[model samples]
Target: MDIVNALALFANFVAVPATAYGAQLALGALGVTLIFGILRFANFSHGELMSFGAMATILVTWTLQDLGIGIAPFPTALLALPVGILASIAVSLATNRMVFRFYQRRRANPIVFAIVSVGVMFVMAGLIRIIIGPDDQSFADGERFLITAFEFQKATGLKEGIAIKQTQVITVVVALVVVAALFWFLRKTRAGKAMRAFSDEEDLALLSGVNPDRVVQIAWIITATLACIAGTLYGLDKTYKPFIFLQILLPIFAATIVGGIGQPVGAILGGFVIAYSEVMVTYAFKKVITYLSPTDWAPEGLVQLLSTDYKFAVSFIILVAVLLIRPTGIIRGKVI
Candidate 1:
């Protein structure tokens, strides 16, 4: 129970992995929130969209690797991100035109739209599994760890070494840039303002000469881009599998719900909150606590709060709690 040691251990647990995971969840939640705001429905298919984008990036990266082209200090998948984004955009737009567009034309209820999205999710899930054969694929190569623990220890001459992966650093930086750009666009740009207008009041926006179809198209494109970025980063940091995307759905939804389904800022905050909670709750703090704690005060039992297998359950519990406490979300997201 040495306070200094306990604080340091907590910091380590909270800082690195939480940051990387928060960025990933934020990116995924951004897409979900945008769809909820603009399209006015919960997109259950978003996780599958992420999987599709990650798979596309993996394919492109492999192709580039075969050609002997790569980013030396970074993963080749980083270089192939744009291709993956474009492919995801195409898929999202095509889905809108073929499946959701019919429902839109008929002015379907929000509940019906939600149901349709679930159907779309199943279809996309099946498509990804068919293409990838439901196998795990590692898409990371090149620089593995950005700063090795030993290197940091050598440089700082501190007993505590901090290891940062190149992919992890990239994930944080890229997510920041993307989120900043999105906020700037939403707040300042003409097209971005138009999108906000549509989300705020579709009828009024239409009367204001905003093109509905164009706004919807742009929303889908932006969502696709965010999905591509998030999915690729997640794949790089962890491993890519069609099934993992489905598993990520709970965290993404948790973020969106906890933040307020249609609120952008809420989504970002919710992502980090969920990520840190899940990581902290499940992480075995034995090594970290031992490093900092005095021998006499250290607990006999492992300091983990929950098993890693229950990560999804943690997210679901948070989602439900948020729903009961503030159904509109912390940001007062529109219920409609």
Candidate 2:
């Protein structure tokens, strides 16, 4: 009974939150990886793209709320997600048209494109901040917790209880749906085949009659949808802040690199690994130990491996290690 309770405590504090966070990170990383694989350059502006979509969603959600519209059990943000995605797609397309196309026409190097993306990142980030300000934007309506601690305790008749947030559940469900749809599209659709063929060999694909422009356009659209969904879900889980989105770029990049930068499945795996590592290391195990051990045997220390403030550093360290150990990544993605 004590062991079970201890595990329950761990699940309540660490597992559930980490899973939701990992799913969100994976979705965000997928956008980054897709762009890198298909577009042949790292778009540093991805974080800003997320911010743009999330800000758009927030604006629309506010408008809907003002009109007394809501989804009740689910967040009204769900309904506004499509609007956010479309806004992101427009921004992506416009940038590709005005800026990326110039580089494409010039046949610039990948590093050049990367440097250009950094400039675009700054411009886009500034625009978002100017438009939305650098404050927390909170607009969520519906159930708060799908399973409360007290309810879990009552149901299980255990000393320790688990609490799962509604947002967390929604995040997992939505991520699974999105991932499934992406896999189906990529595996079964004609355009997806063209994109894959292009990624495999540009010259061969070109000779085989694949349209580079169409492939790039489709990639941007998919990347935009993924970014927008990830951004909105993250904001719903936490809060919408322009600066926070920028910070998220670190973990997202880490996830992408660790999981094999160009591999979709690797991104998902890396996300969970990084998330669980962060949560487990930072979470103080004192309570769980106390529940498990005899009263007198309980430890005095918090038993946390690291402070929560150092959580982001975990991703950096892991990323460096992966780069050093296997440049090709765990699942054999693009070698960096």
Candidate 3:
């Protein structure tokens, strides 16, 4: 019974939150990986792209709420997600056409493109701040928890009960669906094959009659979809803040590099790894340890490796370690 309680406590604090967070990170990393693989540049503006999507969704959600509209069991943001995705796609396409097109035509080096993307990141960040302000936006609505701690305790007769949020479950389910669809598209669709071929060998793919412009468009569209979905889901789970997205870019980049930048599966795997590391490092395990211990004595300390405020440092440490130990990443992706 004590062991079970300990497990329940662990699940409540570490597993569930980490799983949801990992799903969000995976989605964001997928977009980063796709851009790197297809566009041959590290898009520093990807985080701002996420912010832009969430901002759009939040605005739509506010409009709907003002009109007395809601989905009850689900967040109204779900209804606004399509609009957010469309907005993100439009911005992505516009940026590509106006800024990146000239560089592409000039055959600019990847580093130059990366630098340009940093500039774009600042521009998009400014735009998002101008539109949404720098305050946290609470757009989440509908059901709050799938199972509250009290409910779980009453049902299971356990001292430690798991509390599962509705958003956590929804985030996981949506991530699975999106990832499956993306993989299928890449594996079974004609355009997906062309994109893959282009990533593998640009000159050869062009010679094989693959339309470069069409491929680039598809890549941007897919990237925008992934980024928008990820941002909205994350905001639903937490609070939406324009500046937070910029900070989140670190973990996303870390996940991308740790998972192998060009490998989708690696990105997903790395997301889970990074998420678990952050949660576990910051979580206080004193209660779980005391429950599992045979004696009644408890540890004086919190038994946390690090404070929650420094959680992002875990990702940074892991990222630096991966770069030093395995530059190609766990799945042996392309070197940065």
TM-score top scorer: 3
| Model 2 score (lDDT) | 0.90
Q: What local distance difference test score does each model get?
A: 0.89, 0.90, 0.93
The candidate that wins on lDDT is: 3
TM-score for each predicted model, relative to the true structure? 0.94, 0.97, 0.98
Candidate 1 or 2, higher TM-score?
2
Q: How well is each residue in 1-336 modelled by candidate 3, as lDDT tens digits?
A: 289999999999999999999999999999999988888888899999999998999999999999989898998999999999999999999999989888877878999999999999999999998998989889999999999999999999999889999999999999999999999999999999999998888899999999988898899999999999999999999989988888999999999999998888999998899999999999999999999899887989999999999999999999999999999888989986
User: lDDT tens digits, residues 1-336, model 2?
Assistant: 278989999999899999999999999999988888877787789998988999999999999989989889889999899999999999999999888888876768889999999988999988998998989989888999999999999999998889999999999999999999998988999999998888878889999999988898999999999999999999999888888887999989999999998889989988888889888989999988888786648778999989999999999898999999998778899874
Off by over 4 Å in 2: 294-296
Worst 10 residues of 1 by lDDT: 1-10
Residue-level lDDT for 80 in candidate 3: 92
Among residues 3 or more apart in sequence or in different chains, the pairs in candidate 2 whose N, CA or C atoms overlap within 3 Å are: none
- TM-score order, best first, reads 3, 2, 1
Candidate 3 has a TM-score of 0.98
Candidate 3 segments whose C-alpha is farther than 4 A from its true place = none
